[model samples]
Target: MPYQKLTAKELLALGNAAPEVNDSSWCVTWDPSEEGSAAERLVLDTLPPVLDFHTSGSTGPSRCWRRTRETAWLEAGMLAEFVGAGTPHAPGAVVAFAPPLHVYGALATFLVPARLGVPVWYRKEYVGALPETGQRRALVVATPWIFSLLLRHLDWVRSFEHLTVLYSSAMLPSDAGTLLEQAGPGRVTLVELLGSTETGGIAVRRWEGGESPVWTLFPDVTRVDGDAPGDEGAVPLVIRSPRLGHRPGEPQPAEWHTGDLVEPLDDRTFRLVGRIGRLVKVNGRRVNLDETEHRLRARLHCADLALVPVSDPMIGEHVDFYVVPALDTRADELDLSPVLALLGARPRRVHVVPAISRSALGKLRPQQTP
Candidate 1:
């Protein structure tokens, strides 16, 4: 369905007119408003404190998560306060290129504007281009892929005189960040948010050329070292955030152990190493999936690729490559010798596909091999 975009003033008017809900399912609709009809507001305001959000499952299995509405609103309020500071007095519209149903988009794009009383717009599909919001300022809520797409059409991006882009779901490569700043002579600011379905906005870092590749934790969130062993003897990162949710019957955890291994630069900043889950034994040696992918990326011409591990009785686990080749290139014809040399072992196999499957955020999804 085509997403509906409306100004904040228009949405507020609709909500003021009639916010009534009669549906027992708690889902309400607004036929003609981005904020939804009064009925939708009623549902939102009256529903239980709990909200169900599903993970993108980019790394593994997709799981349904339940979080308190309070947590969501708190994050929204924080986003508004943070983004509002740099916005013009008129308040620029929030432009999101992500699915509103997703957690990141829901909080940052939708709820943030709602908190700020600002107009917001959502792009329902990948258009590979951004509309020119003349004169007025804009806060772009998008994923890495959207920014990657924007890089291709930097000329169009210059149209926006003032813009701040929020990138999430995956890490924005340093090179990509460079291209963004170089793109469009106009003013552009990049804010990278690091979090997941389990943890709300944990930390954020503003990307500038030559700055340390470390993330600064949000004031409300704190991190501590953990004993959990991760890939390459890395330690898991433990976090305590008010925005995190707790399951029923379980005591509130003092700290949440993020399976991600990080290098602590100090009390407030850290560098993400990789996910421990990606660690696998190949030829009886530990191999980090992220490291392998990085090595392969340096050697390959493809822009999008994923390295998945498959069980092997002999080697314990064997790597498989799934890649999306450039238009003029053939994925099958690509040499595997470099990849083999990187792993110091041969992959179980390599598959050339039309494109690497991923969520809107450029996070690789688990592929089903034929």
Candidate 2:
């Protein structure tokens, strides 16, 4: 059936405030007004909070995480306040190297900028391609690796008056973050976000002179130690945040158990220690699944691959590589020997497939072997 048995009220709940039959399919009609783009505003407003963003697969295997629009907006507000971006009078713009589809990228690039009514520029090559910020507040969205790489071109933007460099995807390397040169003509603050796709914004750390050890929670978020610390004396953090990505009409837990291991601190703060749950022993040695996968990705220059830890009673565990070889590259032609040699472990077997399926955020999706 082209149309479901639903009333106009039901259609309204489904985002059609005014449902009309153009010919065969139902279409939403909006009242024409100059207050805003009525159609765009209505669409964005009526959207249900339920959405699936994929985890970064850093601490564990990749999975599709259901995030909410409410969470996004809440975090955007928090970010706005943190970056001192409420005033629309200031000339401002956003420049990003991160993909907007990911949670971090979406917040830093689109959501925050859109709220502040500032222009956004996405550059595939950001080394020397930043637009000049003439007395305007500018936010630079980047990953740790890219931020480190961008250090070489610091002098390129010496004229920027106000710049905030926000980076995610792991902590910035100590050497790269040890000092912030004062050559630039502005307060070059550095901000780092610590959170997961499942739980929106957890805590944030900001440093201006140099890297700071203190990580502060958002004004509304709170965290506590889990019931008990798990392996390696790693403490699990339980948090309550108004910015968590949650679905409506579902029974919700009063507090959320974040999978990342953290050190116990006061209510409004905590230090991220490490990741647990996904660590496995291979060849009687500890191996991090995320680290192994990332190392191999950089080594092979391939993004579509995963490492699966299979159990063997005697050997503890072993890795199996599932990869989607690059175009025109044969399965047997790819090499993992040189990389594995440094790791002191090897995959029991490698699976060559036609594709490495991923979600919008580059999280790995399940693949079947032919």
Candidate 3:
């Protein structure tokens, strides 16, 4: 069979024919003009043994990657293992609010469950209707922004008592773990995934409580140590995994050099320091953008803020902060000048915008003014 594309309408018709079609798939698209037509193509096309997708370019341009059948199977098995899928009285079902086109949201929502023969209940229409279901043993895959919106509706929160797992990713805030734990009364298990489109899903953590988040390598993955942490102040992570993406017959690097900075706690667990590209030199001293952003968020009266690089003649490039003030809050109370001083540099500029522009998944849209 050769690969072919079908429109969403044709896909929907196929879906209507047998809503329980195990091998059928749909591609999520936000564009209204091509909605139904696009989905139909994906469904009718010859299914690839390996599915390929890209990540949202909130931080940068999206990168493309391929997922082999083995990779998908391994991911499904790991998810089942983590969530206790086969346990009696806790049969698992998947509900996803993230679009199926992107790696983080859609892959797990559709591929993992479909490959595992688990029933997936997808609502392409009203994503907010997720918690409104009556399913007892349910696993929800959503982004931080969707989770935050769901949290605002207490009625919806109460409806999730039977939920066993709540998974989130793509631009998750550090504090989100703690927030989820408090909101769910520990009945629901919150897992934060760390990975990109290029890397697939690499690590998982509880994301809340005082427990240190650690990376649990997939079954086929191995790590290589670069430099000791706190020495050069950046520890690079190297990966050798069978699950990595590559074209057939092409020689792939045995170890993938990830620009991610990590701190290893023992052999199995590690803490993410930041991305190598995210660090900037300020007056010859290195500044961690993650740390600076954390500090600025603490000082701001706004709901969120992001630090972005702006061209500077003196330093070649300098950081600027953008803030999204909370609704009904006065801007005068949110002074970021002191925060910049604390970060060891006077920011080139500060902009107060109506709201921070974020993707549907809560990733801060880099390069956007606000």
TM-score of each: 0.77, 0.61, 0.74
In model 1, where is the ten-residue run with the lowest total lDDT? 20-29
lDDT leaderboard ranking: 1, 2, 3
Ranking by TM-score: 1, 3, 2
RMSD list, candidates in order: 6.2, 9.2, 8.0
lDDT of 1 by residue, 1-370 (tens): 3344444433333331132210110111123333324423533565446766677887678776667766776686666655654446223566666555567866765566666444555554556345544435667787766765667666655666656777777645544555556764436667778788777788887654445456889889988779666655456889998777655545546778877788788889888876766777778777778767766776878756777878877656788877777777776667667777877787787777776777756676776452
List, in order, the clash count of every candidate structure.
5, 0, 16
Q: Tell me the TM-score of model 1.
A: 0.77
lDDT of 3 by residue, 98-188 (tens): 5656656445664445433344554444323343335556666666555555455545545655454445454455445545665656555
| Each model's lDDT | 0.64, 0.58, 0.58
Distance from true location, Cα of 299 in model 2, Å: 6.4
What digit string (tens of lDDT, one per residue) describes model 2 on residues 178-234? 325643424477777777776777788877764356778777878766888865665
How far off is residue 326 in model 3, in Å? 3.9
Candidate 1 vs 2: which has more lDDT: 1
